[model samples]
Target chain A: MSGVFTEEQEELRRYARQWLDENAPLEAVRKIAETPEGFDAAQWSELGSLGWLGIAVGEAYGGSGFGFMELAVLAEEMGRTLYPSPFLSTVVLGTWLVERLGTDDQKAEILPAVVRGDHRLAVAAGRAAVHDLVARRQGTDWVVSGRARFVLDGHTAHTLIVEAAADDGTRLFLVDGDAGGLERNPLSVMDLTRPQAEVTATDVVASPLGDGRAGDAVDHALDRAVAALAMEQVGGAQACLDMSVEYAKVRHQFGRPIGSFQAIKHMCADMLVGVESARSAAYHLASVIDHDPEEAAIAAPVAKSFCSEAYEKAAGDTIQIHGGIGFTWEHDAHLYLKRAKSSALLFGDPRYHRAVLASRLGIE
Target chain B: MQVVVCVKQIPDPSGTYTLDPETHFLVRPDEQVLDDTDRYGVEMGLQIAQAHGGSVTLVSMGPKGSMQGIRQALAMGADRAVVVDDADLKGSDALTTAQVLAAAIQRTGFDLVITGTESTDGYSGVVPQMLAELLDVPALTYATEVEARDGKVTINRQTSAGYDVVEASLPAVVSVTAGVVEPRYPTFKGIMDAKKKEVEELTASDLGVDTSLRQRVTAVEPAPEREAGVKIEDDGEAHLKVVELLQQKKVI
Candidate 1:
């Protein structure tokens, strides 16, 4: 039970792998990516019914009542299949924010609906300390006005959680997705599997989430999100390694399988090294996030940085190992490459996370 | 509607296998998992138990460490398990295994019994029949689909060409084929609760069953390496060459 992965976790992994293989194969991912919503509503509801959307949320909110480790397992499998969904935006970020920082009333209003797949939520926040949105208190309500870009799943979300600067400090507010004077424009992104949108709000009515400034809460939520993303990156890296090794064994060259060549063999070994190491880092961060938040604070940035670079390396090496066919649009290698690149930049890039790690460790 | 499913813990099939030269038995690795073939039986048993108003009990015979595999089935919603793990039961053949399982199943008391046609490791394909003989129950083998109602079990038994509908009275042995039903994965709650589920461990002596082997391996040999195959280029006369080769092999 105390092992790196418990028996239950391994069983969950097997289950998730089989379900994703059957339901969200790469071909299905391609089809969903071409749609305006970028995900199937029926599948989203199915995920909710399967107790996946609330894998990390507590049971009182009608979730599965599991912890971050279970969520990491589900995220890894979703990443392995390149599952096209709003899970990262809604379940990972929006649900975590509400569960962690929401008032009792807010939790009652939002978390159950989220677990039931009745509402989809998106988070709109700047990458840095400078706020792109500003909030003004008006009687009992608040008015938020700003333009936030790179909002994940913002276009089709039922609600939007925006981080805006109040007169006191940075605060988080919930705004209706279809509120007046709010415009959501879908942005053409390199990673078609995951869509992004630019959200511009002009005097949109909003409800304040929780009480007091949300600067620390926002940072904490972002750290957890990035750590979860690292788990996804690890899954993607392992998938690339699997593809490379499987292809190398069958594709022939010089009257023998190319896997016989030392060059190809060494590349495959290197990919294995990257994948295993990234997996350890990601799992470690997820464990710490659940058991020890103090340790998770430091583990988060380290995992995010290492896993991002490892995924990128594996994806690049996968294409190189596959040779010319990998360069074509028809091949799945490019899809992984694009995902690796986009995911590395999503949250914070390797460089940004490394800086955070260094500063956290008090390195001058 | 008490259901008892016979399961086996075998070495993970994906791992490399070795044969002990002295004993002619497979050298099972430390990493053993539930036999893939048995999953269908467990699924079928669970289904019958759920549809009726009873619980499923898994009965298995393997090494002491076989709890890992048994726990897997328990996590898939089996009520409890009875595992026969004794050092004296090593190298159990098909009939011996059936005798041990029949003892355990009798101890648990079943209204219905289910098993896979064969285990992936052994492939003897005779344990269920032997078990049925020992239990004094009707045997139904190679069932593609099974349903139970009114104290009788009905199965769609797969045959050479199509299938046959077979019905049997209560307390029957049913061997389900692979893909009989899609086994449900353990929900998170089920996985967590499996730790507390009852797993009654018994030795051969505990069940008062005889473990003497009726069959043994005389010798062991590696399978011969495959020879290179000849390729015929598809030319205008390729059909004539194919016909000549078939005639030479006496297949035409």
Candidate 2:
């Protein structure tokens, strides 16, 4: 009951597909991606109002109180359409932590407002890819000072969950994005769909996460985040397959449709295989997150590895199948390719995750 | 303000179908899904019920696999669902479907009945009218927009010449097109809570109806394939050859 999604989940996926088809079409995505804030504010607030922001959140805090699979279904739809938003950064990382690790007071203060779209949040796992931030114990107070790069949605997020190395161990600190001496500079990215920023915290005092179990909490959060990102990859990969298949059907070359060619047909078939495999892997991770976190140590990385590579290959093949028209800037082919590349590098790429999987299996 | 939305179970055509040329019967894998065309009607029903503090009930008729379509609607916050399944009901025509549906609606009282203009599979566009006749109510077809006030419902029905506004008394049947209203995604909480929602199952006999095939499909054949076309090698004479072929085929 907890892990498997019922018929309701199917309806939810259909609803999301329709919503994104109407509200977040490719043109809307293109227009929104050009902005620094990233994503349409109206859609963001609309999602919050629709209770999407709280899909996995508990009912007591204005959430739908569902498991991770519901959220994965939605993220897949959004990724399929390339809906540009900071959903993962704010919802999975910030809102989830506030629920999982924040104090009762903090949960009462933050989760409700986040669910209502009154606040935007971003989380930084120090040195995830690039980290220079340092936490120093000045008397009894903790100050975070240094630069954290590749902070997802950091440019517009009003709240921050900054991880830093303290005197004892690495800990998480909640800091206001607009705090004195905190500077957020947006980064130039190949994928404008998901914006990243370089954050500089200069002697900023902040509150420690509840009970200072930051290590365990951060580990759990990262595992879930990896799995969530894999779901997004599956969505993007499936979209590429759809675009390629549609193109192959109508695109004519020699004497008939290019789909009649054996080479093109095999490419499309290979894409189908990739898309199906990745979907299975990502959903398996969702189940692990819900019912078996212990299995996630192995499942999350395996999913991320398989799905990220599949998405990249699928997007690459989409461009290849579209030929000259796909190479142009005027086409949507390149945009999805860029997103596939960007997401592949995020959290950890296929190589890194494969290493994690192999190490966990004691193969090395 | 009780509303009943008719949903049809369609076998996803993407699945492989087993062809039986002997009996002209095609056995399709039972990956039954709610007809995409009916989603708008269901959304409208749920929306109206939410605004009016009433209940939305879904009705479907198919094989036992029709439960999949029923559960899909129930998951979308429908108060309840009723599925009528009978082997004898197989191959029943649109009017026969109306008889079965009207009987189910009688047990589950409703002020309004809704359906898609046509099922995705059949596309006959006559079930709603047949149901209206069976229930003795106004039949509003091809509604692109709908609104209710007092005891009357107004529909902006689509026609070849733009749209026509039609108002009918309460307890009328409406067949809406695909894009009437944006459907809502079922929330996770709603999906979980759907377990508690009642899905009453009945049969043609229980509805006091004789289920027998009225219309018979005699044959099933794939469409004829097109002939291969001429191919011109991409040299200097390719343009002249293309023009000659086009002239020969009378394409231009």
Candidate 3:
């Protein structure tokens, strides 16, 4: 517990650090943020070629069949560089749900395409979807109507995995993004790095992934997504800490390095502590998810609650460390801050996670 | 076409290396940093193994920390690993390290052995050569590119003038220069796969290498801090000032 990464995992961290330095440089991220999909096909395809999208999926579905640890390992790196990709949405959320709960035919249809980067998909969690969106029986096919707000990568996804309110309680359905009655309006989000949208499904034909029982599947998918995002937050904190420390070293004040000052040193030290704390929690979540699913339930909420705020605090201090320059639109610090803010509230706020943690602890 | 890659684990040079103020020895941190130079050899080994239809075995002889580097190589798709670790091996010189590595590789069974030109901690590039001599194989050092086919290997030995194409038969050792091929990033799946991969552990007695009286570091000293140079303003007499300063420092 003293160190967050294992020897083999450290190898992944090094590899990812170098790869992100070369491929997902800050300038490229800034540029990519302006693109229609917020990520180009080539870059996404390149990640696919690297077998990233299939990290946790089974080999039968064209994945390498690793566990949550491997996924978190990459997620942290992706967050460090603010890598603008659909990895979190597609792999962590969408592909995860499909592979874990989808029928054999369902997995056969979607997972391989996701592995090859041929398909870009997203999940609108049933709990997150507006209750007005209802599933109705239309002859042999099911039709979904109403709205799914805050769908990650909703506009760019070729396919949508939506949780609809049906007679069978909350059910999960997969539908074409361009389904006749579906309208996707991309939201102007603060974190340009990760895009989102609102999907209005009016009589959109839907296919149930399996029995469509939301049950614990949605929670499991969300827990997986939260744990993965927690890693990203810790990573963002690491990035901010590195930047602040570097800036503190060179940015002198009173004819001396600011890093030499007690205030700056304490701030930097606190940032380090914050990041390492969140990192440990997130790593514990991943380890538990892989080894003990029941334990993952307890760890995920703590990870989410702590990590979201840690990233925000770390990013905020990063801007403060840079003084006036960090406030400018041209600088990268604001982008991180924005990402921290949006990510804090993406799945649910710290209050929500804390509530979840409290309930799990039987303290509610 | 089984390839064996020799790797060394070093503390991150970017971080401060503290001295065990009580003892004069450098207090090694628990941090695990793979020698950046060795990545090229790992990449080359994997490429050869993939192209020739065989596995790449990684052999490392260092502290337990060496598993950090070995695990990294395995994550990059090396088949398995052999770690020869013992507390007695500390302060052993290049020759001692090469002996342990040679013994480990003998057990691993490799047609070709790959190593970085030098390690970060000890830039003594002599170990690979010593390893080759111990194994009784041709040593190709500082190769910019390596190709394997038909029980033979060819390497482009880098030189100031140009690279020299050298061919060695199978069962050879090649020290690869960095930038042969961009080492592939260890995918998440690969890292997980590596965790399940077998790691054959060996010790001093297992390797039958007497580690007690080998070449030991007599003393360790940090490099002297560089003195700040005197800067002369760009006045008419700045050139004269430069000359005076140079002569004062005995450059004349």
Candidate 4:
């Protein structure tokens, strides 16, 4: 049997596609890029109205009562259209952590707003792209003074979910974005489509989430997040290859379509191979994230590593295929390149993920 | 609020069709495809159903291959599909096709029906009105904006003069125009799920409609090939070239 999605997933795909076609087409994407904030407020509000931003949130909290796979489908479409939103942060990380680890009151209060797209949240796990859950708690008012850089959508997020030490126990804290002791500044990054930021926390107003019990849940969610991000990266990389192939076909040189040449054809073919392989890995990872985290953890790195390089190679070759035109500022090829690089680094880059996989597999 | 969209899966008109120059007519030796306008119709149906909380059943009158377009509709959020397929009904024109579909609508019993104003291939822009006449229900054509409230349907129709706001009673047939909304790309998951959505197969006999029609393809002629002629050098030259081309064509 082929690796086709199940019947329910197909239904979700239909709904997602319909929504995206109307709400986020190429022209909508252009409009977003032209905006100063790079976000279409009306579009985001519409997505909220459709219950898309909260696909994974529980029904009690104003979501569509779907699973992570549904959210993963939305993420894939978002990646395809290069939709700029803090979906991964607020929906995936913030809501996941709060729902699984926060106090019941917190869940009741915060989860609903997160689902409504009214509350945008970010996470600060500290300097490293990848880190083990480690925290040191202070007194009753836990002061989490650490550094978390390159946080996705961190610059504009309303709240920061910080990983801090609580009595030598790993803990999650809800740190106020505008807290007096905390500082966050946007970073100059390659991916202009989605901004990244470096955050510094001092003795900030912190509320411990599930105290020490949140560690295991946070770790589990992180694994799923990694897998989800890897899947999105694969989608983005696949799109980059597709755009390049499409461009190569129409562009003419020496009285023939450039795609007719063996060199460009070979490049496209190779990119296809990489994309297909990465897709298999990414889809398999998404398929297993709920049931088999260990396997998903292993597959996540493989997909990310392969896709990270595949996209970079494909993006560079796309520029090469278009020659001077692809290199120009007006062209959109470079935007994909930036996104590919940024997505590769998020949730651990190819190298970092590979190393984690090596340890998990006992490879060395 | 049940909204029925009548969509026809015609060949894509935007692209060049396969042809046998020797015979001098369009040759569809391969598979036939649906028009883009019909896709927007399907999308609009889905949108109305989603907003109004009702069902959308996609109905079509064509061969078995046209089931693909119905399935595409199902994937886009239609509750089900009803395809009226028949061998003797092969050469039915727009009027006969609409009659058969109207019969299907009579059987299905929908609150509202939707369709493209015109298929890209046939460019008839007549099916919705034909269906409305057959069904004896009020109709709205070329609807760009539609709202249903208190069993009344209000529509904004695109007209040569401007947009006309038209309202009708509970049950109606609507024909959508081009550029209404973007048709969705079928996701991998949707394709898998659409297989399970009930796609009831119907025929002309099933609808109890006669297949006989006066319209037939007597002698096909290739549409005149459009030529690319004008080449404007720069901004100033573009204006001059435009005037020159218009003068040559006697348009200005």
Worst 10 residues of 2 chain A by lDDT: A1-10
* 3 or 4, greater by lDDT: 3
Candidate 3 lDDT, B55-138, residue by residue in tens: 888888777664666677778889988888888887677888898999999988889999999987778889999999999999
Model 1 agreement with the true structure over A1-364: per-residue lDDT tens digits = 3377777787787778867887889999999999999998898887786677877888898988888888888888888988988988899888988888789998988998888788899998645222389999888889999898889899999999899988988888889999998999899999999899989989999988787357576777777788778888988998999999999999999999999999999999999998999988898998888678778889988898899999999999999999999898999999999899988998888998889888888993
| Candidate 4 TM-score, true structure as reference | 0.83
TM-score of each prediction? 0.86, 0.82, 0.80, 0.83
Q: After superposition, how far is residue B219 of candidate 4 from its true place, in Å?
A: 4.3
- Candidate 3 or 2, higher lDDT: 3
lDDT (10s digit) by residue, model 4, range B1-252: 787787766554546766545533344422455556777888888888888798988888777563555676776667888888787676678788888999998998889888888776666678889899999998888888878768888889987657999999978887877777776555443555678899888888888888876675656665699998756688656888888888877777
Give me the displacement of residue A358 in model 3, in angstroms. 8.3
- How well does each candidate reproduce the native contacts, as fnat? 0.38, 0.62, 0.76, 0.14
Report chain A TM-scores, every model.
0.97, 0.96, 0.96, 0.90
Total backbone collisions for each predicted model? 0, 0, 0, 11
Compared with the true structure, the alpha-carbon lDDT of candidate 4 equals 0.74
Tens-digit lDDT string for candidate 1 (B1-252):
999999989988877888888878888765578898888899999888888889999999988473667877888889999989887788888888898999999989999999999999998999999999999999998999999979999999998657999999998999999999988666677777898999888899998988887678998777799989878999788999999998887777
Order the candidate numbers by TM-score, best to worst: 1, 4, 2, 3
On the 0 to 100 scale, the lDDT of residue A294 in model 3 is: 88
Could you tell which candidate, 3 or 4, scores higher by TM-score? 4
Stretches of candidate 3 exceeding 4 Å from the true structure: A2-28, A40-52, A64-70, A127-139, A145-149, A165-171, A178-185, A198-203, A259-306, A329-331, A350-364, B17-32, B80-110, B133-136, B187-252
Tens digits of per-residue lDDT, candidate 2, A1-364, equal 2245555676678678867987888988999999879878888888887778988889899887887878888888888988888788888778888888889988888888888877888998832436767788778878899988899999899888888877787887888888888999999998999899999989998777775557577777888888788888988998999999999999999879999999999999999999899988898898789778779888988998899889999999999999999999889999899989998999888898889889988996
